[model samples]
Target: MATRTASCSCGQLRIEVNGEPLGVGVCHCLSCQQRTGSVFAALAAFRTPYTVTGEAREYLRTGDQGGRFLFRFCPVCGTNLFHTEEDVGDRSVAVAVGGFADPSFPPPEASVYDCRRHGWVVLPADVTVYDKDPE
Candidate 1:
């Protein structure tokens, strides 16, 4: 198992994972773009038992599919660090890939909401793309 740590811009909030992510993906949904203030959002999902440090503020939003998502961010820097789906229980947490600040972090395995993907954005040929959330 490898240990990886991700933190907010101000380093006030941090998440430490004990093992590699169970899955990595990029989402191009409109909400994701707005949430990240970027063309898309890249995330890595990890099983529970990870560690979190520092104070965080949370925001709850409803997904396009009507599922609730709870996002946690650093209260100091206002950086969105991670999120979890309300319907999924506490089995996993999705962390923003940029928080790791590692260029070598694994590439995304899936691209969701490709229907909304920016025309200028190009993904690796090997990535699995979904026009929308996979059924």
Candidate 2:
């Protein structure tokens, strides 16, 4: 199994994951854009039981799909680290792709919130797209 490591900008927070990610994808919802301060937010989901180090500040917000979204960031440098889904129970955890120390992490297989994506942002021709949520 491959172990991935990540850290905040100030190096105050660090995370190490054992094995590969559960999934990876980009979210184009308005909330995601606002939270990430970008056109879309990239995320890598993983199963529990991984080693996570350092203390991170968190913010919780509700999503358009009525799911509760949590954002965890470094309190010092304000580096976004990971997030958790309230609606999907507690078995899954999502880490920001940018936080990964690996340069060749898994690419996103699908995209969400296509309805809110920027017109100039063209998606891959073969990837699955969701207008709103995956459901």
- The number of clashing residue pairs in model 1 is 0
lDDT of 1 by residue, 13-77 (tens): 99998788999999999999999999999999999977999999999999878899999999899
TM-score of 2: 0.90
lDDT of 2 by residue, 1-135 (tens): 777877877888887777788888889998889887899988888877666688889899987767887888999888888888888887878888988766787778889999998999877677789998876
Q: Output the worst ten-in-a-row residue range by lDDT, candidate 1.
A: 15-24
lDDT of each: 0.95, 0.83
In model 1, what is the error at residue 17, expressed in angstroms? 1.1
Worst 10 residues of 2 by lDDT: 45-54
- Model 1 gets an lDDT of 0.95
RMSD of 2: 1.5
How many clashing pairs does model 2 include? 0
Give the per-residue Cα lDDT of candidate 2 at 106. 77
